[model samples]
Target: MNLYKLGKFLCTVIFYPLYRIKVIGKENIPKDGPVIICSNHISNFDPPVVGITSDRNIYFMAKEELFKNKFFGGILKRVHAFPIKRGMRDRNALRQGLNVLKENHALGLFPEGTRQKNGEVGKGLAGAGFFALRSEATIVPCAIIGPYQKFKPLKVVYGEPIDMTSFRQEKASAQVVTDRIMEEIRQLHKNHR
Candidate 1:
């Protein structure tokens, strides 16, 4: 198996048993076609939590800083993650994301741009919306809640895909679209509470 699939298999075996990981609305995920897995940033475990809960292979936009170490960076790259510079548009990163979608693959990302340790929703950066618009991909709202501690319940909810085609026609601002996406995620969390 490829590195990404291998990692996913290992994580699924380990994470599901180690933690009480409850997944809901998985059927809402589109079985085919390019999709943006837009989610709220929680802890570092957010990616794997969302990744493992879904059947698709999710290519994540990991922060550039995490790739500073060559050894770790290699592993990240092998696992289908690419470096993204945070707090800026970073055109190259944007292009990379669009390319992933153009190939009809799932691109996983956090609209907030970074993790929020407190679990409260934060203002979303415009990157996610920008990618969805450029690639004409549907954005699937997902929410991950819980501590990554052994035996603690970790909840992951996959909401229905938020159509971006209408927004593209209206020429919606990336910031506005991103905020709307975040709101969808927030509502998902609220419903689960």
Candidate 2:
């Protein structure tokens, strides 16, 4: 019962029921070990939606601006959400993400970069792919269907893990690996729909 898990539990108890959330494939999540949970970004609430449904601490890469607010930042920190500069390659953010994986922690990365209102899956950033290749951690592809509005039961479908060990040995290009990861996520979305 660490602070992160506790906060996530509280969030699940409070918000999940109110939203009538229905999470599928909870068993798909690895019971333990370092892993990257890649998902699609729809709304601002998507992060918390995944967090509450997860049984482990999910280190989420949120935009740096979100940390500017003292009150909100405090809460975000409690739930293991960290800041990442939005456009361009932010080395600092990348290092932080790698450290989370090295420490045998779970991370949440939305490959689409930012939220898409059009509901189209966008290109994924190379950050998560790089981390997966370097750490040789498993990559879990997940999909979130529906909005986070009141009475709208958000659906989350978690897919089986994608092993990254081969990528690590072959030293795959970040773009190539990221594209593969994104394609898997897209497939998961299509299957769920």
- Give the alpha carbon lDDT tens digit for every residue of 37-95 in model 2: 98888888788888888786789988989999999998888778889888888888888
Q: Can you give the lDDT of residue 69 in candidate 1?
A: 100
Task: State the weakest 10-residue window (summed lDDT) of model 1.
Answer: 129-138
Show model 1 residue runs off by greater than 4 Å.
Answer: none
Give me the overall lDDT of model 1.
0.87
**What tens digits encode model 1's per-residue C-alpha lDDT throughout 1-193?**
8888888899899999888899999998887789899989888888877889998888999999999999999999998899988877788888888889998889998988878888887889888778877786778999887667899888898999897878999999988899899999999988886
**lDDT (CA) per prediction:** 0.87, 0.83
Q: Which pairs of residues clash in candidate 1, taking residues 3 or more apart in a chain or in different chains? A: none
Please give the lDDT score for candidate 2: 0.83
Off by over 4 Å in 2: 1-3
Instruction: Give the TM-score comparing model 2 with the true structure, all chains together.
Output: 0.91
